[model samples]
Target chain A: MTSWLPTLQTATPEDGYDLAVKLARVAVKATQPDAAVRDRLRPEYAEDADALIAVSHVVATHFATVAAANNYWRNRT
Target chain B: MTSWLPTLQTATPEDGYDLAVKLARVAVKATQPDAAVRDRLRPEYAEDADALIAVSHVVATHFATVAAANNYWRNRT
Candidate 1:
């Protein structure tokens, strides 16, 4: 099957945001050396599983905001 | 050199912030398909060189804020 992925050229803010979210997840996992740490990282925002996903969204939003600001400044100049 | 880096067990908010900034820089570089694109990413904040560095700070601050919030929530639970 042909892959739908596009060739690498440059990342738009959206792409940066998506990548940031993925990287954050990896970093979080790297931080967790044991079940205790993983359990501690769990959120009270929602259910245990849902909380973890929400954390991803929170980090993603932060990244997307910065990426948008970067793009805005890039366009301005 | 001792490298001074600690083993990865858990990340503090500061660690997350620093890692976010570095990862963002890599992602930005990966996004550049050509010299022109790289040039365009150049900022006009201070001087050309300073502007680029400032961009990292901006993104880092955002990451730090989110990380702090995450920690707060994690602790609360």
Candidate 2:
């Protein structure tokens, strides 16, 4: 498998945000390689609002990390 | 802001997975527009294992939906 953690680079904050989401998803795939199991368990949390909010929270954390890693993508020429 | 629910299309399963992640992020942004507020709350869920797991659960749910929408990106001759 490819490296789970790749070098962070983005041209814009939106791209950084997108990369953050990718990181979150990559972390998930790394933890759970079984797609069938993940699919089977989806319904348990799919409709739960709190669970969904947790998703956003994790993504936000990732976005923050990615933003900081790129220095908020500042000073771009 | 762009449409949160953009038309989903992907050339491969990986891209589809990326789109699923995007969808998850868009959902979050749509629900919460305040970046500072989200950043403030990030630490609460960032270190919580259960909260992190919930992120995967939600992503899987979104992946399942995207996979179905794209017919699993199968039979691409």
> For model 1, how does the per-residue alpha-carbon lDDT over A1-77 read when each residue is reduced to its tens digit?
77432422223434545545555555667677676776664433222222322344445455645454444223321
**Cα lDDT of model 2 by residue, A1-77, tens digit:** 66343345567999878876775667565445567755654676667787667767767766765566567667887
Which CAPRI quality tier does the interface of model 1 achieve? incorrect
lDDT of 1 at A39: 64
DockQ of each: 0.03, 0.06
Q: What's the true lDDT of residue A28 in model 2?
A: 62
Specify the CAPRI tier of model 2.
Answer: incorrect
| Model 2 lDDT at residue B33 | 93
Chain B TM-score of predicted candidate 1 relative to the true chain B:
0.41
Give the number of the best model, judged by lDDT.
2
Clashing pairs in 2: none
Per-candidate TM-score, chain A: 0.40, 0.78
